[model samples]
Target: MKKKIINGFLQILGIMIVGAIIGYSVGKIAGDSLSKVDTPNIILLLIAGVVVFILQVIIHEAGHLVFGLLSGYKFISFRVFDFKIIKDENGKLKIRYERLAGTGGQCLMRAPEYVEGKFKYRLYLLGGVIFNIIFSIVSWLILPSYYTLLFALIGFVLAFLNLIPMGFNDGMTFYHASKDETTRFILHLQLEYIYYQSIGKNLLIEKPEIVEKINSLEITNTNYLTDALEFIKLDGLEYFFEFDALYNESRKLYIERDDLLPVYKVELMALLVKLISLVNPEDELLEELMNDKSLKVRLKQNNPQTKNILATYENGVKLDDEKALNLINEARKIKNKAPNLYIQNLEMKYCDYLENNIIK
Candidate 1:
């Protein structure tokens, strides 16, 4: 509790400090620009601000893509807002629409092999910050116009926001990478986990060593990325058909960790619902989860896993075998549209599990 309080305090304090710096810089730049030119059009300036902000977000993610490729990382996806360009299972780049809460953009890459206890990560992690700083400097010094000043101001603020180690920002992830070897190793494993999924590599059967490493690791770090590591471990357990252990671990994580990313919370809850349905159909937690709006939203998504979980709930808990069977069929068909081979495999397996084992 004390550690959380101190960390929270530090995060708030850091944000305030950066806010002050940005405020002062913006004032100075705006004053200087206004003194040199006539009154600027407010409507035009607002439009320009919006355009510049979107462009900066693209540049930021592009920085990660550039630096990651240079560091031997392979591209997986690049997304800005809701638009994404992803390397599909066919090894072709295709446009898709997806968005996560809180982030404006993302650049995902397949990690290089972890050789000799090290892999290139520093430049890739700091690439966005570097690009933002460079662009801001250029806007402020070379292009001395009001619009350019606005661009500089926004870029400068974005750079500092990401540079500070708070929340789920790149700064915090980089901080862990720089200071903790375990975190770095976890990151490598996590990235490799995704890479394997993209290629339809089953970690349980084909990459048992990876699953063993995941099972061996203790969740010693408080980082969300570490939480992600733990998440895949639970996933591996499910794939290995370790139901009892998966139940206990999933329950413990669900009950104890309230600070999980929303997506993780929903995923874990879905897992729990399946477990509870198989074990004790009338479990109170099942009712609670069923009533949860977030869970409902997740179930409504067009993903196969969601349909499978709902199938399990219907079959095991509600004794609606017909509905459950229909859901299983739907899940199987939906698996064809899964984002990657890994997910497609899991979805198919889960649908089979529901049909053969869970449903009466």
Candidate 2:
């Protein structure tokens, strides 16, 4: 309670300080003998401001994309507001229209493992802010129009704000990721697997170092990294039952931190476990998870077909060949991206096996 009050006071104090500075800057600029513009010109200036602001956001995300791809990371998805572009199973980019909670835009990339790759991801993390700073400086130099000046101001503020290490922002993740070798190493390997999967490669993969670290179990308490490693290790394991134990373990970890956890992220991971582990999740359990008002709402909004498929998977044992095939067709026919493509493909593969069709 005391800490909250202190933090709140500090936030207000900082806002007031910034406001004063901005007011002073405006007064100084206005007093410098600037000519008054006509109403039409003013309207054009406002439109330019809006256009430049949007353009800057695109430039910011592009920074991350450029740095990430150059740093041995593969692009997974790029989202701007409700529009997302994700790589499909055939390694083709597919656009999905969806909205994420409390986020404006993001570029997701998967990092590959390299033993000597230290501080490499820092560029990917700070790419947006770095680009923002450079762009602002260039804009100030090249175009000193009022709209451009406003753009530079917003750009500088955005760059600096992204540096504050809080929430799910790049700064906090970068700070945590850069310091933790075990977690970072595991993530690299996991991403490497996804890269291979993107090109239709899947195999049982193991890393002794990762296994040893997981077994030791004496890491930071309730870390997302731990949850990630716990679940990520299950990838590409052929035996369905092998995934069951880890699924439970990871699910427990996720449940403990459910409130703070990103729902779709963890649930998508859970879907992977359920499908790859080849366990037909208990009907009650499936209902409990998918029926959870929060997840249900998201699923319905993002991919109603996926929500149907999950419910279908829970009752898979009862569905005959035609029915199972129909479900797979329905999911695949959906224009938007599946919530968990890996899971969807796995389920479809399982259904095909029942249908006695050769899977390519």
Candidate 3:
């Protein structure tokens, strides 16, 4: 707890320092007109500030798109904070709100396969940063108006802010992922999976091939976020013991992940492992998961199927066949991210295990 708090303090300190530098630079380049804007009301200034901040975020995402396209990467989704622009069932663009912590916005690019020991993904990953810096330079060069300077300065500062390299920030993702073959492979696989899902298709992960390759790799250690995500994408449930080991390795990282969704996901995986295993879980693990504030909040906010699955785990409440079928029906009606197999399998289990039980 002390270490995490210290790290948090250090991160904040670094941001403030970097921010100060950027602010000074912006003032020198763009001047005090931005800070001392002439506005009718304070509320107008606040609203204008919000608008510019959001625009910078959009430009940052656009940077990713531009460079990703340049590098032969295809777009999957673009998110500004919780508002996502992604393809619907008909491959038409659809927008939805999905609030997440530590994410002001994002651009997801589907990468082409990496050639033997050749990684082209660093460009796509770094694309947004590269573009943000470029935009800042352009803004500085153009010597635009004070309001324009506000947009430019925000863009400049936000770009630098993303480079702090901790807690799912751009710099950290780049640092950890750079020149790492295993990590590159994980990225490749993720893109492939996302592509299949985008088209509303089930990606067939060849289990034996992937498992053998993962085993053969000379990995010193596995990253919790990357490896766990890869494992689940590759059907890790079939290899319960291996997934359990990865889960243990990634437990801390998952808990501390910037977003709350991963926390819920890992716990759900743990529960499935317990269901399949002959041995029981330590009571503490279960208690810890249940006590999670994010998971609790997430449970309340999710759609019905997600809510049901978590509810089942939380209460161990078995559903009757009639109720089980109803749940299955309801689940089919609500759309969600693909390959949520826990609910699917559990729904089937409810039918198989509970359907014929005598109710007196």
TM per candidate comes to 0.83, 0.68, 0.74
Q: Sort the predicted structures by TM-score, highest score first.
A: 1, 3, 2
- Give the lDDT ranking, best first: 1, 3, 2
Q: What pairs collide in candidate 2?
A: none
Residue 262 CA error for candidate 3 (Å)? 6.7
Worst 10 residues of 3 by lDDT: 274-283
Candidate 2 lDDT at 311 equals 38
lDDT of 2 by residue, 1-360 (tens): 586568758866765677568547754764432344322377787888778777777778888998898887778877777777878767788776656675667777777556755736788888888888789778756755566567777776666557666445677667667766765655555565555444444423334465555566555644455555545555434325354564555465555654444643545543543443245544345545554566655545535345344434534534344565565566556534443355445545544553354122
For model 3, the local distance difference test gives 0.59
Tell me the tens digit of each residue's lDDT in model 1 across 160-267: 878888777789889987767778887777777777777777555676686677667666666778888768768778777787888888888998998897778987
How big is the positional error of residue 91 in model 1, measured in Å on the Cα after superposition? 2.3
Between candidates 1 and 2, the one scoring higher on TM-score is: 1
Stretches of candidate 3 above 4 Å error?
A: 32-40, 88-99, 137-143, 200-208, 229-285, 311-315, 318-333, 336-360
Q: Which is the better candidate, 1 or 3, if ranked by TM-score?
A: 1
Report lDDT (CA) for all predictions: 0.80, 0.59, 0.59
Query: What is the alpha-carbon RMSD of candidate 3 to the true structure?
Result: 5.4
